[model samples]
Target: MTTTLQINGRPVAVTAEDDTPLLWVLRGELRMNGTKFGCGKALCGACTVMLDGEAVRSCATPLAAVQGRAVSTIEGVKGPEIDALRRAWTELDVVQCGYCQSGQLMSACALLRHTPKPSDADIDAAMSGNICRCGTYPRIRAAIHLAAGDDRR
Candidate 1:
C-alpha cells in the first residue's frame, strides 16, 4: 500500500506493506535513521518517535496507523525545546554509549513539551521506559531539569 503521512510538518508518501513498522519506512524508505531499532519489541524505547507530537515506539507502530498523522523523528526535532534539551545533553554528558540517546531525547522532549516544569518523579516516570545502559540516569535527570528551566513555555 502507498500511504501519505504528515511527518514533521511535511507531507511524506511511502509505498509498502500495510503492516510494515513505521521504523522501517522512516529509516529504510524515507531514509530517516534517527529512530533506532533496538529490541524491535515495544519493551525497549530505542525506536521512539513523536507521532503527532507525542512520544511513540515506532518499531511497533504500524505505518497504516500513522498514515494521516504527523510523525516526528529525532531528525525532525527542532525549535527551542529541542535546542535547549540538546545543549543540556551535551553539557551534562548525558550520553554514554549513544545508541539509546535518540530515544531518550525523544522521551525527554515529550515530557518537557507536556510538563514545562516537571519534578524528579515526573522525569523518572516519563523516562523510565527509555533505558541508557551506560547508567547516565543522574545526568539525564539533571539535564532535563536544566532544559525545562529554559522552557519556551
Candidate 2:
C-alpha cells in the first residue's frame, strides 16, 4: 500500500505495507540513515524520532500510525536549540562510539526546547528512556546543562 508522511520538514510518499516499521521506510526507502537500528524494539532509543515534536521510537512505530504526522529526525533539528545541543555535546565530549549520541541529542533537544532550564531530576526523567552503552550519563547531564546555557551562565 502507499503511505504519505511528513518527515524532516518535507512530505514523502512511500509505498510499503501499513505494518512496515517507519525505520525501514526511513533508512531503506527514503535513504535517511541517521536513525539507526539497534534492538528493532522500542526498548532502545536508537531509532528515536520526533513525531509532532515529541520523541517516538521509530523502530516500533508502524508507518500507518504516522501517516500525515510530522516526523523530525536528527537531520531536521535546526536553529538555536539543536545548535546549542550539538555544541554542548562537543564541548562536554558526550559521544563515545557515536552510535547512541543521535538519540541522546534528540531527546535532550526536546527537553531543552520545552523546559529550557530543566533541573537535574527533570533531565534524568527526560533522558531515562534512552540508554547509552558507553555509560555517558554524566556527560549527557553536563551537556544538557551546557546546551540550556545554564552552565557558567
Q: Roughly what TM-score does model 1 have, to 2 decimal places?
A: 0.94
- TM-scores of all candidate predictions against the true structure: 0.94, 0.95
Question: Which residue pairs show collisions in model 1?
Answer: none
Candidate 2 regions with alpha-carbon error over 4 angstroms = none
lDDT of each: 0.88, 0.87
104-127 per-residue lDDT for model 1 (tens digits)? 999999999999889988999999
Superposition error at 145 for model 2 (Å)? 0.6
Off by over 4 Å in 1: 150-153
Clashing pairs for model 2 are none
Find the 10 residues in a row with the least total lDDT in model 2: 144-153
**Candidate 2 global CA lDDT score:** 0.87
lDDT of 1 at 128: 89
* lDDT at residue 7 of model 1 (Cα atoms): 84
CA displacement after TM-score superposition, residue 80 of candidate 1 (Å) = 1.5
Error of 1 at 79 (Å): 2.2
Q: Residue 142 lDDT in model 1?
A: 91
